[model samples]
Target chain A: AQSVAQPEDQVNVAEGNPLTVKCTYSVSGNPYLFWYVQYPNRGLQFLLKYITGDNLVKGSYGFEAEFNKSQTSFHLKKPSALVSDSALYFCAVENGNKLVFGAGTILRVKS
Target chain B: EAGVVQSPRYKIIEKKQPVAFWCNPISGHNTLYWYLQNLGQGPELLIRYENEEAVDDSQLPKDRFSAERLKGVDSTLKIQPAELGDSAVYLCASSFGSGAYNEQFFGPGTRLTVL
Candidate 1:
């Protein structure tokens, strides 16, 4: 069985400051991780994915995530937060062709 | 470059009523998925399709729910005699490939409210 955990329900950040959203996972084999964002009443938009490459991955909208093998964590990060970044973020792990998602984290960026 | 499209942005029906939702995946995308998302929760996969074949539907409630993807382009999900617990957002997503690492593109979901 595969599962994902996002401990925080909400994360608050200030505009122009760095932000981090924590995510952890449990899987039998190697994990394929991904991050997605969902705005109000909108569908989830893919941010980044970690398949089999560098630990640090860059994605759309100046977003990035670091994959920690030892810690079994994949945390989304942004260098400078923007009000537009306020949304719901989800971390997922792919088992076979199925993706299991975490509960999600609400990100609020204050301008 | 049209993304996945879904209809009936919002639907409200009394308990025991039937409802259906539709989805059209991105052009030439063979894999399609339907997910259910409750308030403040992550989306859970209800079913998955590869072309015209339903490759996965283990999580789907076959007792009251049914789905089909005829012609392998457009798909429909139906629930007969919906229950109050059925209220949630139904989302459709598609990926370019059937590979494990394929990134999925999502559709603006249909919000269903069962009264």
Candidate 2:
């Protein structure tokens, strides 16, 4: 079965500081990874995805993720965090047409 | 372009009561999905529709949960005799096609609370 794991339950970072949310996956074949952000009371918003070519994929809200094949990890990163950037981040893997998601990591950006 | 739309943004029902949520996917989207998201957890696929056909429903709890996407444009998910465990955000998503890499657009989920 294809699955995703987000190691951290929560990540706290100060405003303007860099942030990273770790994600790893286990799949039978090559993986198609995605990152989504959910704000309070809202559905998830797509951030970025790593499908085929680029190992380093850039996404919305100044976010990027590096897909490491060896480690089976795709960690979301941002150069500078904004208070508005705080939200629940989810990493997902595509298995066929279904997407298996991670538990999610709550990102808190303190000003 | 309008995104996926879900009705009854919030609902509170007593345990064992019945509830239903509705969703309308984006125009021209042929694939629709229903997901259940528990608190502090990621969304889990409950059902998926390709056009008017239910292509995937393995994860859906057939005993208490039922869903339909008639005409392949709008869908509805219903839970009969709802339980407290069923209280969660029900998300609806749609994509242009039923491909592995097609990006899905999600709606602001319907939050359900079973008292």
Regions of candidate 2 where Cα sits further than 4 Å from its true position: none
The C-alpha stretches of model 1 lying farther than 4 A from their native spots are none
Minimum summed lDDT over a 10-residue window in model 1 chain B is located at: B95-104
Q: Can you tell me the DockQ of model 2?
A: 0.86
DockQ of each: 0.84, 0.86
A1-111 per-residue lDDT for model 1 (tens digits): 999999999999999999999999998878899999999988999999999879999999999999998999999999999999999999999987988999999999998
> What CAPRI grade goes to candidate 1?
high
lDDT of 1 at A105: 100
Task: Enumerate residue pairs that collide in model 1.
Answer: none
lDDT against the true structure, per candidate, is: 0.95, 0.95
